[model samples]
Target: MEQKEKQILVSIISSIVILASYSLYVYHKFMAGNPGIINDFRFWGRAFLILIPVAIMAQIIIHIIFAIIHKIVTDEDLSTKNDERDKLIELKSIRISHWLFTLGFFLSMGSQAFGKPPWVMFITLICSGFIASIASEGAKIFFYRKGL
Candidate 1:
């Protein structure tokens, strides 16, 4: 209906899609005996490069869905509609994500002191970092919506 509503819906759906895909990838890797996504960073790097188009398409889809929702809700032509609050929330979430990732990286390195395989620690750190970042952002959004 409203631009805000459309944006919120699009954001939620895109997040769900991304998280689902990532979970499936993790499950597939586990079934294939890889057990960890980043254990094969070389392969992941190439795959990530090749999947850039998919990522772009996902973004485009998110925008398109938002546009459609906006049209349906307001019966108005689609136009860019964003506000400072949205941007501020996104920026803060990204900052938290970065900090979580950095902490995870350092923890992975610290694992080396305990004689763990570098690859294992690295992969574990990456997975944990991603999960933590996503969880943190989700919590932030939840709190924001709950009037925290």
Candidate 2:
């Protein structure tokens, strides 16, 4: 278990947790309402206000858990010393993530152009961000496994 692999694991887990929890929350809080919430700007506001901070906090906690696990497993510091190959792997992963983000942005725009609800567009954007993150972290793990 390399540092990057641990990081990728944390990232994927965090994405799954945050997205699933937010989706469930939205379903219960907004979708379960009498008239529903698709057209409501308050829906968008609440989603943003809740999801962003919650996701950030979840990631922070997940990283700390990974750090503790690494310490216990390897008896080594979690702060890894990055070498040239590590840097290259990270750069390549980021390149892939950038493309995903660009695509997601366009998807959001297309949704809006088709007269989709604000909630739908925001969902597209949020999903894209999550996908971008997972793809980047997955690429990093792949590169690590493939020997950079």
lDDT of candidates 1 onward, in order: 0.63, 0.84
Give each model a TM-score: 0.59, 0.84
Model 2 stretches with alpha carbons more than 4 Å out: none
Q: Candidate 2 on 2-84: residue-level lDDT in tens?
A: 66787778788878988898889778876885455677888778887888888889989988888888789889887667889
Highest lDDT among the candidates is held by which one? 2
Candidate 1: clashing pairs of residues:
none
Tens-place lDDT per residue, model 1, 1-148, is 4445445556656766765686577457543665554466666555446445665688688788777876797788765655676667667667777777777877787788778765657466646555665665575565357533
Query: By TM-score, how accurate is candidate 1?
Result: 0.59
RMSD of 2: 2.1
